[model samples]
Target: MHPSTPGSTDQHVLHSAAQWLSAGSPVWLATVVATYGSSPRPVGSLLAWSADFGMAGSLSGGCVEEDLIARLRAGQVDGGQPQLLLFGDNAAEQARYRLPCGGHLQILLQRLGKDDLAGIQQMLAWLSSRTPFVREVSLHASGQRLTLLQHDSPQTCRLTSEYFIQPFQPAYQLLIVGAGEVARHLAALAQPAGFAVTICDHREEFLQGFDAPGAELRCAMPDTLISQRFADSHSAIVALAHDPRLDDMAMLDAFDTRAFYIGAMGSLATSAKRRERLTGLGVSSTQLQRLHAPIGLDIGSKTPYEIALSVLAHLLAERPQRS
Candidate 1:
């Protein structure tokens, strides 16, 4: 599956591939097209393959993916023009694929090759630069070829693709305003959920207090740090510190870009005060609307860990609604 966070899709594919290859099995990748009735994996979930076996990201909890892997190893994927794989559903009879339960899913498995490896590499590069890509792959009885297309507005180029289209967006980036305990907690929680998290603070003392795994630490001025590095819609900016100087300028810079979610951590009183200060500094109402002050949802979070969960939950809640 493609993640909005940078590099996670390619990372998962490569990781799964390595795992399969290490076990001396040829691998195939199965992608989900549609889902119904409480499916475990969503539309874009992925399953990796090797000749012997495979591991799926979230496809079918080892039941379906394992079965698919066995079929792939036995050269069973050599049938059907547009193969239809069903899981958790037993309603209709398609001559191609079927599932026992009504949790219907559609999957297409293509054998991996050198060209596929190159395509994954290219997708990884675009993700690293925070670029949105809509990848179209042409599949044959043998292999697949990919073309990378940029994601733009509705008025953008029209696709006349005869091949299948797989859209990939880099994950939302986290710009942690303060590198404190709460920031560390948030950053650590975000990575596996496929968020690329970065912590920014000028104070070495505060920055040194963090040691979150998979988070990028930046001990630089927040404004310049964000301006140089973050400038895309696939980012979420947050001001976590209780300091105006540290959070204000960086958030202002974030306003100039297409960052999807902008938030701040504080109480209702603190948020009101912060709002007044920001208005005094000329932050417009529209820009202010982008801010999620009194950050996180009404989860009654008190401790750092609980606050972190609230913050991430709010992020997920807002993601599907983002423009």
Candidate 2:
């Protein structure tokens, strides 16, 4: 995950749960049951609790979670039946809790078994596939209670019972064509930002100098190189090599794919020339416009490092705002 954007607490919950299981201990899964007005965590926000590690993730704002953590550490927890935790709004006791925005929230804390961990792993598999998923957990209390929740859905709720959410996508990928200086810099900068970066070039010299950590280096033909790599909405393609034959082939291949960003490196004259060549290759003007020619943002970048920073700034500009 990017330092700028830490991963969702959902992943942390699963991680904590797995940690507890590995250490031969039991863990509890805490999820927001309902929300009123403007709770910090919407319904479905998860917090995993274990005897040893306390809590990972949050069920509500700081106050409620601190209370939950203390309760979790105490060890004699209830089971089989889900409890409702209310904060802020309506109830006098809730107002004492002072949940931000005066909103009310409900939470369900359930002890997790080994089988429950397996189910969480299953959800992670689905998330890796980049497909949306909704899970209905069957909790047998006095009888059997069925609760349905979507990971990454948009629906929110007000009761401590059930709701929906859209799980954040972690598959944003960066395809860097031409393993040159700019490619190296970009690979280094983009990797720490949670982008799965891949650097491609046929030149052995370029590959030899490619030392960016967490980036994949490929010495393959650009046209067919991108075929097996990108598969979803979070994919981006960039051509840092000014070589027309190399960059053009990759750009052409990417144009047919679902990559959200496609950029090429060149000056104004060079970009115009490349455009003419592309038009000659039967690429329409509209298609040609998709190329972010002159690659990075116009930041008056002089060095390769500065240019890479400019490119990354442009890419980050496309990200949605955080809540």
Candidate 3:
């Protein structure tokens, strides 16, 4: 049975699908085009399924994948047409699939041919470059098109009686400016939460042998890193170094970027002092308002892991369409 992980991004599934197609395996693309009530995954969630290669994405948290695969294997689904498959439309189906009470999922299931590999590659290129694009599909039949979206395009999916359109953006990024325990824990937590984590520290000593799986480790100046890259609207910058030398400089560069969350870890008094110092350094009051001093939700966290949890929660709260 193919497993479902709600954590995989759209790039991941598309990437895998492209790989499978290259290796001569036919892949099925399943997308959650619409949802109602208690859906486990969002409307834009994707699942790539191949009889020879299992699955590489998630449409629901549980039984939906197995059921869909069963239908696929039975030859009930064919490559000739794109169709909408609905789950949890009634009480019995909801209970059978263990869907949240009243939850419903409408998925667009399409069989991919080798000719579509180029489109998948293009989608991957767009995601890698942080470009936004839209994939529109006819819900009732085999028709599809891709459109490059404006930089300000809304990051969401829409479903109508005739079509489904989803705007695809790059993965969320988290640049944690520290190599300390809190940064390690946050990186470990953020990866599965779908943030591409980068841990930056200027001190080589702090970076020595530090490990957080899937996190990019950089022993570089944080300020230069922020201003040069990692400052887009999809990025969140958090300074956990606590050292004014490192954290304050990072903050200055962070303010100039379009980063959605700019935060620094500290106690209330420390944060107050930090604000005073920043204001003295010419950080306008308006810019200072965007800084989340004493970063994270007020969860009264004492340990590193707890603090990371609160920080992740706050980040999620600030994120759009988190559900």
**Could you estimate the TM-score for every candidate?**
0.82, 0.71, 0.93
Q: Report the CA-based lDDT of candidate 1 relative to the real structure.
A: 0.68
The best candidate by TM-score is 3
Q: What is the lDDT of residue 286 in candidate 1?
A: 89
Clashes of each: 14, 6, 0
Per-residue lDDT, model 3, residue 102, is: 91
**True lDDT of residue 5, candidate 2:** 23
- Which of the two, 1 or 3, has more lDDT? 3
Considering every candidate listed, which one attains the maximal lDDT? 3
Q: Candidate 1 deviates by what RMSD?
A: 4.5
- Tens digits of per-residue lDDT, candidate 3, 198-236, equal 999989999998988899999999878898768787789
Give the 10-residue window scoring lowest on summed lDDT in candidate 1. 153-162
lDDT of 1 by residue, 191-243 (tens): 87768889888889987656878888888887777776766666788888878
lDDT of each model, Cα atoms only? 0.68, 0.69, 0.85
Candidates ranked, most accurate by TM-score first? 3, 1, 2
